[model samples]
Target: MAKKVAHADYHGPSGGWGSVRALGAILRREGNAGSTALALRRQNKHGGFMCVSCAWAKPSPPHVFEFCENGAKATAWDLTSERIDPAFLQRHSVTELEALPDHDLEQAGRLTEPMRWNPVTDRYEPVAWEEAFRHIGQELKALSPDSVVFYASGRPSNEAAYMYQLLARLYGTNNLPDSSNMCHESTSVALPKSLGVPVGTVTLEDFEKADCILIFGQNTASNSPRMLHQLDEAARRGVPIINFNPLRERGLERFINPQNPAQMVATGSKRIASEDHRLRAGGDMAAMVGICRLLLDWDEEARQRGEAPLLDWAFIRAHTHGFEAFADAVRRHDWAAIERRSGLTRGALEGVARHYAAARNTLGIYGMGLTQHRMGVETVQMLVSLLLLRGNIGRAGAGICPVRGHSNVQGQRAVWITEKPELVPLHRLGEMFGFDPPRKKGLDSVEAAGKVISGEVRAVFQLGGNLVRSLPERRLLEPAWRRLRMTVMVTTKLNRSHLVHGEIAYLLPCLSRIEIDRQASGPQTVSMEDSTSCIHASRGIREPASPHLRSEPAIIAGIAKAALPSNPRLDWNAWVGNYDLVRQAIAATYPEWYADYSRRMWEPGGFHRANPAREREWRTETGRANFVAPESLEADPDVRIADGEVLNLITVRSNDQFNTTIYGYDDRFRGIHGSRDVVMMNPEDMQRLGLQATDRVTLIAAVQDGVHRDVQDLQVVPFELPAGCAAGYYPECNPLLPLWHHAKESHVPAAKSIPVRVVRQA
Candidate 1:
């Protein structure tokens, strides 16, 4: 039967899912509204003003049309049509709300008023602002502050994040677990150890200057389509792009820049991928090892011929240490060993090696597609290792770009998250507040989830992010959520994260970034740090969605006031009244680019934070750069492909979707619309099972480890794929992602490498 469509009331799949992030994909998806504003602000402020949504940025003055279909859709998702109000929740029971699908829950709208779960009614009821504030304060005051879990999302602005950390520390706990813990914790944890910078070294400008771009594990065309235009420009200038991923995304295949009327009015646009490779999902480390092996061999051959070697030997001697140890480790693995595991031919590896050997400036760009596996950290380490192999870290056009997911996610970490004692930010937090902070290392996302599961953590306060869907194990996570004494969500929009209320829950509505602030400060502009470590001001160009809505900062201050009424830990009202004071506080603590942040913000293009690498200064302990080889290649974990299972399922995002948010299902990129239950699989796998494309099949995720996960009535379709592999979209398949199945060092949930068996259950 054909579905009936009502005018202005048509319904289908809401295409909202941000980056895979740590939960789904790496920094490889659409940007949330906050992320969009942050990216736009940076682009309007600087040279590499790239779109965070889909890699659409113009080095030569970026424009709105520079963004792609997904980018626009991403923008729309941020400026959503839904509204979350007190009356909405008043009408629905807590259990009933929980029963709604993830998409339905989010589509209901932006949060309008502060709400608390009424124990008697078993439903969330609107609570007065004063009552809400008092309830929060009483709860925090009752518990040992150290036991309270303070969680922040990457989506939160730097100012909000700094304040969040400040409030937590002043209250006396270092449990500052946030979104970074989920996605790039390894990047955060590894890079400081690897190259002394936990963030991407390459700015948006680097994309235009690089001679060769090797994008591994990143599906930029779909994930960040805006980036494809840059690659298109690089291709026009005769630069090479070596793309590596499991699936051949259409976005990477080609791009038609609408901004160019010649191309837009005519047929197709510019091409993106000159050469692409699809490695086994978990085999990036091994694939990279092969490339390194090839480089070393080429270097030796050049030396034998009395020719200068390909490696920047001078740079290594003056800047890097531990090369000898790293070289020794690379020597242990032979070419064949590298190929067998990586599923790449020896020539494919050499082709990449040859390009690296010749290109003066090579940017190794990657997304979460690389980091969400058992070897994700190793995969990222391998990419960084590639840059280090040839002195690419601190160069103008050469570096490892992790392509951060959230807008202010990098910004949040800038002043607040991963607090370092050496930095003045932490010092000022202590000095200004007159409070002693806990010096212990705080729990990360995975560890926090583990803490919640183990019943060590009691309460959870999510600043702005979907905590439940964002975590690894849904079954474990759902129950763990219920165990909490309280779960407070401060969000502008409604999402499944708010629905998964704890036994005691509070929902607070906050101002959207697009809104104007008419506070006592007269008018205020918010500052955010972009991927390249540049701090710029973000002023809302549009009116606020609601007259009653408060800014996120104001909402957070309200929470802080609720948590601590006596002495009011950090002078919440004073700081929230004017964000500049927060900036001055930031400047007082971290005197780098923010020395006179307010004055500097008035200037065009904002200020770039000081990175020693940018100045050709080495911050390593040896006073030199170091390149260490990975101890081992990343092997595909043992997900037994027994007789019953059809193929190993890999979870992916459709072009229309961001991470977990549903705008309305229309994946314009893939030409798939209306539904998301369809699967893309290898023809061989389906043929063996006597099933064709679109055949209904139930994926029984009996992952041999005794963990059970399943996807029922899945419609499988034949697509281009390696014999053993298959692909399906996410959240539908999110359950298949086992909690224990994560990168060894980085507890980033292995959404890519699911050790599951897929089958046709009639």
Candidate 2:
């Protein structure tokens, strides 16, 4: 047996938000100048245009000295002076590494070699690339493609994701689940049904000219620091920016623009929000419905007063249908009912209404905070409705902005992986990969994870992802991974997913986007679309850390060769060697924007795909933007509302994090120092429980099944959030979210809303 060390949570020496700042300073202390420069250069060259972390950033790119405290940490940690080689693996067994903390293992360094888990030594051992490929092919060949699930992380390049999806479908399965499936699957699934497209309706420029901005679920200050500039610009223009969330986030509350030298010197910053509304989590859809109800009610009152109506009759008549039913639903629900559900008084709700009538143009921006609940799909629809009432969607400076979470999550989804589409624009995907398209819908992320855990899934080939930690329900996925016949990961760094040892597990290190790719043909450039739907070319700026790292495209090509050695259906080498050929295939099939991908991506800002829907040109069967009115604006399971317990436990990301991966321990804006153990609870809840700011508590998730999934202790911090609501760190609080507890339509975990009971620790 091996002795283990307790996991350290860095609570500042004084205990509180001060510790977070020192943690940030300590993180910068680690020498990372070289990698930092390279990473910064990538952002400048490629990253300068749009953030790779969250949404389509509208502000000008940050300069060398312009990094936010959190962005500085995200970049710094990625460029750290550490390396994980086979030697590290030799020193530690698989069991031992699995026991190590996620941050501790990553802090060791970037993985430097291809590794395989050895049963004999119970450790991971290095193997030649050829041997690993051969073993992978054999295992894949033995299983049916339908039985295998391919989980993709957003970190992979567009070309890599394109190739990975192609490989999975060609190998005979469309079990393609990704990070988007967990976060924005609601937007992906519901947007097309309502808006005739799966992406956001607004472009980046919309943020600049909008008279009013209603931001929901997203903590812009923490997640996409660059976007704060847009809010600052909006404020300067006197635009009323309204924010809604359970916790009163520091970012949305007030942002001190680090870019403003005068402000920084004065120790004062720009205010992003003119007014903020802290609505209970899972109450967003209802609050939005209240706004709609107010609009409709005002229109009715105007008719009685012989005054002008609140709705844009011209736009509504020309662009939409179901207005009758939509208006009917809004009319049925009044201010009192909506106010009761939303936790905002009728007066406050009217304030939101007054802002709507006052602003000629408005922009609505949302994040997973809105899309990760049971009403995720409905919430997205309500926002669409909110925009449509004033006729915001088709116009400039007013539209719906679904802030995508990963650097290129939205971009990748555009390039390939069209799961639920009528036509699928598959000509390009088909001709490029040289395989007949599998005319079938496949399992989504939650569905795939459920299938895997239930022994229905025999194998999994995740392209650049950490599923065990990346997804919800560790209790489910951990055991499911062990039962896998084979598990293969194509990655740039070693992570928790690498340790989910199967009957046969292999970790194939791949090239990062920042590294040079030298193939037999020549150096290659891959294109990725930004959240705003602008595409750009990304070529490596630095050499690979080691010669062993293969590009994701090359790995997919190799896997294709091994999987279909004698298949006449595919020419794996042709697509792999000359990426241009793949681009040509894309052009031949999907000519919307990628008709000449090489030429288009070469342009400075890349090409914007034609958005016919931008002009209210719906591509749906009806050829008009349609309305989807839910029977009830209310959704989500009945959260256990104890006398002193919290109802909605929404999960959120900090500045030092991107989704599941932790970059560091500092969340500067949130006043969270050194550790992620603190949970943000309403001050009223604290009083009810006799808790203070730093009171530690044991949180047992109120699951319906009576199963204490991943119940753990979390420190309680009294925040200015609304009563009955609380916020906690993700992947830590992820266990509290059940695998089965996802959105009704999207199947994404309801991380935004969970029932919880807290007790002061003994």
For each candidate, give its TM-score against the true structure.
0.90, 0.93
lDDT of 2 by residue, 550-610 (tens): 8888888887777765667556677777788777766666776678787877665566777
Best by lDDT: 2
Query: Model 1, range 592-611, lDDT digits (tens) per residue?
Result: 65788887755555667777
Badly placed stretches (over 4 Å) of model 1 are 1-60, 64-68, 78-82, 419-425, 565-569, 635-648, 702-706
User: Using alpha carbons, what is the TM-score of model 1?
Assistant: 0.90
> Worst ten-residue run, lDDT, model 1?
5-14
lDDT of each: 0.69, 0.73
**Residue-pair clashes per candidate:** 38, 8
Full-model lDDT, candidate 1: 0.69
lDDT of 2 at 734: 76
List runs of model 2 lying over 4 Å from the truth. 1-30, 38-52, 58-72, 418-423, 426-434, 567-570, 640-646
- Report lDDT (Cα) of residue 323, candidate 2: 81
